[model samples]
Target: MFCCYESGFGKVNRFVALFARQSVVNEPPLGASDFKAAPLLQTHLLKHGQGGSGSAGSNFFRALALFGAGASGLLSCATIAYASDEAEHGLECPSYPWPHKGILSSYDHASIRRGHQVYQQVCASCHSMSLISYRDLVGVAYTEEETKAMAAEIEVVDGPNDEGEMFTRPGKLSDRFPQPYANEQAARFANGGAYPPDLSLITKARHDGQNYVFALLTGYRDPPAGVSVISASQALLCFVL
Candidate 1:
């Protein structure tokens, strides 16, 4: 016998029992006539109201639903969880199809440049990369003069403190990025208790690195029947661009 609870407005109780008397050995050929045996006995108990008994069909269906629920619950409990996939149903090329291998390599310099442009226009409002010197922008193909000009635009304070008092500094690579909040605690408080993760090395640290980055940027979708997709506002990469 097994006992379980079914939750609705509150809770309902249920029980299922299975018993066998004796085992019978069967000879070969195993014809349908040779397999004649007694009918299996099955009972279902469901408590609905203060003083009420359920019909046979209702009890049988209830028992079936309970069994299905139990089996699904067991299977769900035993499964190992993994991150949801973002790949779509269609394929770009199918002749040499491989679910994992068939994915396109999406390293595009133009896209990275565009991403930088988007970052400067929007993300720079709340995030700053003090570790990334303007000089480092050269790696993204910016000219030396442009880098210097960009560096000069953001001033960094410097002076000797004879009296021993802290002063405001503009901005510098030596300084950590200027967070939207004073600290992680403050940031969490401001963003609905969700602390924004630092974006440094996000592209590199993610699994599959650049490919994952590209796919995630394009993954937002709508809800469906079994496990429908949802168009999400959440993403590490700036997908809007």
Candidate 2:
């Protein structure tokens, strides 16, 4: 027997179970067979709930739901449980049809450039992308010349000079992105003892990170009353002209 819970009301797998329990329910199926089956189906379903041996109708539909859920990852008991858990710990994310999605889709270069500009202006104040370098931006978001110019805007620490002294020079394409703070201790001190993590590690470190980040940027809202107690998703990106 498949155990499940229905949230309030919906016309789905839950509706099937709910319908089975009903003495009479309106269903618009185009056939005399549906009418013929309802009598047997109702009898079997009602008996199944009462600890009697279930009939083929109950087993067949439940099995169908299980397989469909496994394949499509929806309409199963597990989906509800997972959603409830996420609702407890985090805000629900609204879906958006992002341009750069799916097998045939490619990155939106102009939008990416704008987003990168925002990251540099605002998010760079707290987050560091230690794993990424300026060269990675070349041919992706910005041209080689533009990236080189941006790299040169920052001063990078170079090897010990002729006099055995470390010196700073204009940053090169090879230099890792500059950090917001000099060290972990400084980072903590500046941010109320909370060390801002390296944004470069987000994709590798977090499950479903791309969606998570997108959610974090857009998931500020009041959850359904009494349904969830949510924690915040921090969004540091700021879009400015």
Candidate 3:
């Protein structure tokens, strides 16, 4: 019985040794770096999908890199757009009459006042200076009495309408400059083929505001020695509009 047990133990040892050798031969060898690189290769190849060649896997990686670069570019543009929106609109305005020279003058309270006077005397018949209120002129160094006096000159429209009747009221500090023409249609009709534009925000809206104004004011000519007369405003309207 001892001899039979010993023989059975030896057979067990032989079987175990043969199984270990077979396992070693069947299993593939892998290094640490190979293990790490395997997931990367699988991911790249999967993006290319089944039946994709090695070259296709490389292309997949290239496409992924381009997508990442494009995403980065979009992020950069968004940052610039955010910065631009945060910047002051007035400071970036093309028409804020500065760093340029013409008859309209630089941006200043005094220049605005002078321009207002010039506008009232020379340009107001056709154009409306509607963006500013009389109250805003207080910063122009006008005394209260002077401001009142100026206000008293213009007639304002007021009162409730049963008859839709018009009544004259003294201009107040809060009133914006009134329109000369009844509306855009009337303005266009009066100016031949062009419409008289509002001057209120002109200095803030136009890039060539100063030169354009200066040129318009001084551009009147006799056409030529024998040519027919054309209105200066007409000529200026052609260039500006």
Instruction: Say what the RMSD of model 1 is.
Output: 15.4
lDDT of 3 by residue, 1-241 (tens): 3355345433433333332343346433233444243344445444554332445644554555465456556666887887776462223322333643557754466666787788888888998877877787786746667777898888998875688787889998888877888888888889885887787778456545565556556654444545554434233322422
In candidate 2, what are the lDDT values of residues 1-241, reduced to their tens digit? 1332232222244534444443235344223344343344445555454222345555665674565456445546567887787766454344558777788999988887997898899899999999899999998899999999999999988979899999999998999999999999999999888998888878567445566677666645554545544334332222110
Q: For candidate 1, report its TM-score.
A: 0.42
Clashes of 2: 0
Model 1, span 97-209: residue lDDT tens: 22444357533556567777787787665555545655556556466665555555554546646777656555543444344556778777776677665666765665555
Give candidate 3's total backbone clashes. Answer: 0
Which of 1 and 3 is ahead in TM-score? 3
Ranked by TM-score, top first: 2, 3, 1
Each model's TM-score? 0.42, 0.54, 0.50
- lDDT for model 1: 0.46
lDDT of each: 0.46, 0.66, 0.60
Q: Which ten residues in a row have the lowest lDDT in candidate 3?
A: 88-97
Candidate 2 backbone collisions, by pair:
none
Any runs in candidate 1 off by more than 4 Å, and if so which?
1-110, 125-130, 155-160, 168-177, 224-241
